[model samples]
Structures are given as structure tokens and as C-alpha cells.
Target: MNARIEADAAFTDWMQHVQAGMEGTLDAYLPAVTEIPARLHQAMRYTALDGGKRVRPLLVYAAGELFEAPEELLGRAAAAVEMIHVYSLVHDDMPCMDDDALRRGKPTVHVRYDEPTALLVGDALQAQAFAVLSGNVEEQYAARQLKMLHLLAQAAGSTGMCGGQAIDLASVGMTLSLAELEQMHRLKTGALLRAAILLGACSGKHLTVVEQAALEAYSCPISLAFQVVDDILDATADSATLGKTAGKDAADNKPTYVSILGLSESQALAEKLRNDAHKALEQFGNKARRLHELADLIVQRKA
Candidate 1:
């Protein structure tokens, strides 16, 4: 095969491996549908196992591979991060929140099941994430693992994602300066994405201050870029292509980069962020090839 075709094949294979591994790992961690509170557990499964791209878990495995972290350690950590992500989606789609009725090309948990069941699904997934992380992480890195647990808590709690969501809820139909918007996304979206990389990298070995700095340079921009592209997609794509309610931001009057910056400027900014991600990975040499690919994937993805 030609080099370009060979590279494409490799990329496809890498994505398959990571996605399949995460699916299996998540399956092992999530409660069986037959368990008590069966409805809640089943809803959790529906929300989590749905067809959304496993971006966070792929980041986990990719970054962990850089440090040669044990696959077992990466699997547990990835599961935790993904569960937290799914929980956020469930709550985001609630009547009290985004009020969307579809996600990943299917009816959202709240729409398919009852609102109360969807609420319980989010709560259960969050708790299950911690259970999987704390219960299975190897004791050899007890101190490190504890720090990882704390990191996830901070990322998901009042200081991070929740804080950002509160800001988002308050800012509806209200204009925010670009700085304010960036800060909100940094906390709301970037925090968890950053934690995914850190957790993955930290799983195997401690990174030097310089390496840590580099990873941030890559993750921070890409995190924001992820949101920017999301805004762009919501504006440009249809619900069928996006597998969720497209144009919801405009419909709901939510503030977004595309709203304030205009489509051309937002697209420019996303490209800048993608370039910044590439520059940041220079220190990692070829080992960060997957990271580079992932950064590109975040912006270039259709859904």
C-alpha cells in the first residue's frame, strides 16, 4: 500500500482498538440491567453505551500509551472518565437543563424513560465512576491514584464542570465577552478533557514539569476547540448528521463562539487551536502521533 493509505489504515485501526476497549471496559463496570433499580441501571446503560464517540477514553488510552502505563490501569481510569461524561450528558438533556429529547441519534434518557429515572441515571453513573476508579486502581500507585480521584472530583464538581454549567445557565440570552466565554468553556468542557489527559499520563509515571506544561498546551486549546467545533456543527449540520438536536444553541439562545464571533471567525479560531495543539506536541516527538491525530479529529469530525 502507498504511505498515505497505510497511514489511514493505521489511524482507523487505532481508533477501533481504543473504542472497542473502552466499550468492553465500560461494560464491565456498569451495573447489569438485571440489578435492582433495574430501570435506572438500564437507563444509565442506554445513555452511556449509545453511539457517541468515546473521545475522552481514547484520550486516556493515547496519553497513557505515552507513559507505557499498564493497559489495566488505563482501562479503569478511562471507564471513570467516560461514566462521568455520560452522567453529564444525561443531566444536560433533562427538562431542567438543555431539555433536549435526542442524543447520539436516539431519544435521550429523560425522553425515553421518565425524568426521575434519567435523574437517577446521572447520579448512579457518577457514583459508579468513582467506584470503578477507587475500587480497581492498583495500590502500587496509591498516592498517585488518590490524587487522580481528587482530580476527577474537582473536574466534575463546583470548581469545574458544574461551575461552568451554572455560568452557562445564567448566561442564556445574555451576551458574554470572548474572554468570559472562553473561561466558561475552559471550566465546563476543558477541565474534564484536561483531566482525561492528565489521568492517562499520570497513570504510568510522573511527568516532568516541562512535559506537563506541554500536555496542557495541547489539551487546553483542543478542549476549547472541541466546543467551538461543536458550535459550528450545531449551526451547520442537521440533527441526523449530528445525532442530536442541531441548532439548539440558537433555538435556546445559548451563547456560543459562533454566536459572538461569527461563522468565519469561529472557524478561524478553531484552526488556530488545532495548530496550537500540533505545536505543543513537538516535544513528544513521534510518540504523540496519536495525540496529534486526536487533536485533528476533534476539529475535523462531522458529529
Candidate 2:
């Protein structure tokens, strides 16, 4: 095989390993179905376990591996970030939000269970994420772990994902400039993704100001590109391919890259962002191979 094919195979192996390992890690960290609130616990597992691309956790592992972070620490951080991501999805699918009935090819939490259970599931998962991240903190890494916790909270709270989501709700049926759309997604979609990378890097050691800046620059384009590709997929792909309702954004009349830039332009924008993501990692060289591949995957994925 060619070198490109070799690298793709290696990355496929690594991706499978991480995905499988996260299943066990999350299962162990989550509350048991037999826990006091059995129904709520079951719902939490239903929404969180065994679904989706797990891109956030994959980013966590890739960044963590780049920094030579400990495997155990990386696992905790990965599971924590994924829990937060899943919680956001749960809430986003509620009638109060997107009102979707399917996610990851399964009935949404609110659809499978009741609205109240879904709400509690999201709440419980968020709390569980912090609990897992905060548990078993070593004295040597206490300060660093504390910072990780703070970063996650900031990412999930107002001024981050929640703020972006609020803007999305209001933007329906309204026209927004490209700059405005970028700003909203920066918080809603990019914040947690940025946090996933930073949290993984922080797990290994302290980051120099320069290193942090480079990582920040790299994250900016990749994060936005992820959303750009999502817009493209939503516009063109089917629900079976996407594992969720397709054309929902257009159906809801939400402003998207496709709506604003046209399908071809939106696709070109995604490619440009992917290139930007690669350029930002030039300084990191081969150490960022996984990150480079991830950037490609984000833009090139069919769903």
C-alpha cells in the first residue's frame, strides 16, 4: 500500500480502539441502572452509551496522545467531555429545543422516555461528567485537574454552548451575516470542541503560552469547519446516512452556510477551513498527524 493508505489504516485502527475503550470508560463512570433513581439512570445510559462518531472523545485522545498524556487521565477526560456532549444533545432534542425524535439512529431521549425524564437525564449526565472528572484527583495534578473542571464548566455554560444555542433558537426565520453565524457557532459548537483539545493537552503537563496559542489557532478553524460540514451534510445527505433527521435546518428555516453561501460555496468554505486547520498545525509537524487526519475527516465525512 502507499504511504497515504498506510496512514489511513493506522488511523482507522486507532479510532476503533478509542471508540471501543470509551464505551467501557463511560459505562464504568455512569451511574448504574440499579441506582436509586433507576429510571433516570437508565435514561442517562440510553442517551450516552454506544452511539455517534464520538468525535469529541476522538479529539481528546488525539490531543492527549500528542502531549503524551497518561492513558488513565486521558480516559477520564475523554469520558467527561463526551458526557457533556451527550447531555447537550439530549437537551437539544427536547420539544423546547429542536424537538427531534431521532439521534445516533435511535429514538431521542425525550422521545424514548418522557420529557421530564429526558430533562433529568441531561441534568444528571452533566453532573456525572463533573463528578467523573473530579474524582480520584492526584495531589500533584490537583491544580491542573481543577483548571480542567473550570474549563469544562465554562464551555458548557453561558458565554459558551448555551449562549450559542440561545442565539440559534432566536435566529430561526431571521437572516444573519456570515460573521454573525460564525460567532454563534463558535460558542455553541466550537466551545466544547476547543475544551476537548485543551483538556487533553492539560492532562499531560503545563502548556507554555506559545503552545497554547498554537493549539488555539488550530482549534478555531477545525471547530468551525465541523459545523460547516454539518451544514453541508444536512443539506445534501439523508437521515439514514446522517443518523438523524436530514434537511431539518432548512426545514426549520435556520440560517446555514449552505443557505447563505449556496451549496457549492459552502463546500468550498469547508475545504478552505480544512486547509486552514492543516496550516495551523505546521509548527507541530508529525506530532500532529492524528490532528491533521481528524481535520480531513471532519470536512470529508459524508455524514
Candidate 3:
């Protein structure tokens, strides 16, 4: 029990360190508030810095460390992935989409700024993400970084996150099958997540076909597990706890794991996916400890 407690403490310490470091990394990459587009840059900084669980960035760090990627490379990759994620959130909370007022325990970008400003924030952030991913890297890493940029684009493009959002908008008030629901989330939520893991691993060195396959298998389940836990929390937790509106799925009459499978079943599926995620990492042994810990964190997070 003491050993388990100590392990938990260590993971907590590591998580906090990465989360804090990301603030500086993201801040450095973002345009200064005094830039020519002062308001836009300010809103960009406001939305990107000092908020949320940075799970995608943590995933990038954890996966990159597996292949012994350089810290500089990992930082750029993590920041790029997070920029795409934050931009999505900004657009998602607009009146045309989820239309929520709160995010990361504060007013969302659309609520804090006008809709037009929010629109530009998302667009500018999306452009900046690619620029950061592709810039300031050594000549040796240029080739790999270009491919990483392409991967990030696909994940954020019409066939990835945007595609998923489209499905979600269309899925509202409709009864979707279990398979259908999973497919939607795989693109919507999972694509970027998969990108984070792959980007991290690729940042270090060239991967063998087997290495790539193993990482793919590992990402598949955790991606779904992330969304399952999210649905569970949205159904059971409160607005204050979630830092956003709770029960929004039901309120919007959207399909979710909880709504389709019931609360208990959704919880069970999350656990099963957690197990699958752990199993997929067996080939990496202790090298994958951080990834394993992250799987648990994603499934067990309260908010």
C-alpha cells in the first residue's frame, strides 16, 4: 500500500511538472498580446494558456519519451497538438455549435469575446499550429517534422476532427448504434489523440512497422475510453466539477455512451478499453509506464 501511494504521488508530481512546463511552452509559441492584432493575439493567449488537463500534450510527452525523443522536439509537437485542440474547443463553444458559456472553469472564447473574434481565434490558432510544428527545428528533423505536420493536418481536417464534429451535429436527437457512436468519436475525439501519440513517438526516431502497429493498437482503445469517461462525467458530475455545463448531452438530446449503453454499461466499457490499452503496451514493458498511467488517468479522471 505504501509503495502504491508513493507511485501515485510520483505520477501526480510528473503530471504537474508537464502541465506547468506546457504553460511556458505554449506562451512562448503564441503571439504576444502587444502584437499588431492585439485583441486577437490576447484572446489566443487567453484561450491557450493556463487551463484544462493537457492530456493530449501529456500523451505526446509520454509517447515521445518511449523512443527517447529530445525535449525540444517533444515540446514543439505537444504545443502543436494542444493548439489544434484549443482551437477546436473555441469553435465548438460558439453559438453555431455547442453554444456553451463556460470552459476550463471560465467563460469560453466565444463568450469572453465576440463570435467573429472567436472564429478568427480558431482560424489563427490552426494556422499557428502548423507553423510551430514545422518551424525552429534542426535540419536533421526537417523531413520528419514535415510528415508530422501533415499528420496533424489530417487529424484536424474535414476527415478527422472536423468530420467528427459534423457527425456529432447530425447525430443530435438521433438514435445511433453502438458501432455508429464509436465510429463518430473515433474521428471526432480519437483522431487528434492518435495523432498526439504518433507524433510523440515519431519525433524521436524512425519506427519499425511493428512499432507503429503496436502504437496504433494502443491508441485505438484509449481514444474511445477518453470519450466514454467524458460522457460518464457529463452525465454524473456537476457544472462546477466539469468546469463546463454538465448534462449537456442529455440537454442537447445527443447520443453518447451513457445515453445508449446506460451509465453502468458505459463505465464497464471504459474499464474494458482501459484494460485493452494496458495490454497493447505489453511489448514495451516498463518503457510504457507513463502511457499506462495515462490510460488509468483518462478512465478514472473525475472532471
How far is 276's C-alpha from truth in model 3 (Å)? Answer: 0.2
Ranking by TM-score: 3, 2, 1
RMSD of 2: 0.9
Cα-based RMSD of candidate 3 = 0.7
Write model 1 residue lDDT over 1-303, tens digit each, in one string.
Answer: 698788778887999988987778888899998998787778888888847799999899889988888777788889999999889999999999999998999999988998989888999899998998887455687877788899899999988998999999999999899999999999899999999999999888888999999999999998999999999999999999998999999999989999899999999999999999999999899899889889989989999
Scored by Cα lDDT, where does model 3 land? 0.95
TM-score of model 2 (CA atoms):
0.98
Pairs in steric clash, model 1: none
How many clashes in candidate 2? 0
| Per-residue alpha-carbon lDDT of candidate 2 for residues 153-189, written as tens digits (9 for 90 to 100) | 9999999999999999999999999999999999999
Worst 10 residues of 3 by lDDT: 134-143
Off by over 4 Å in 1: none
After superposition on all CA atoms, what RMSD does each candidate show versus the true structure?
A: 1.2, 0.9, 0.7
Model 2 Cα shift for residue 82 (angstroms): 0.7
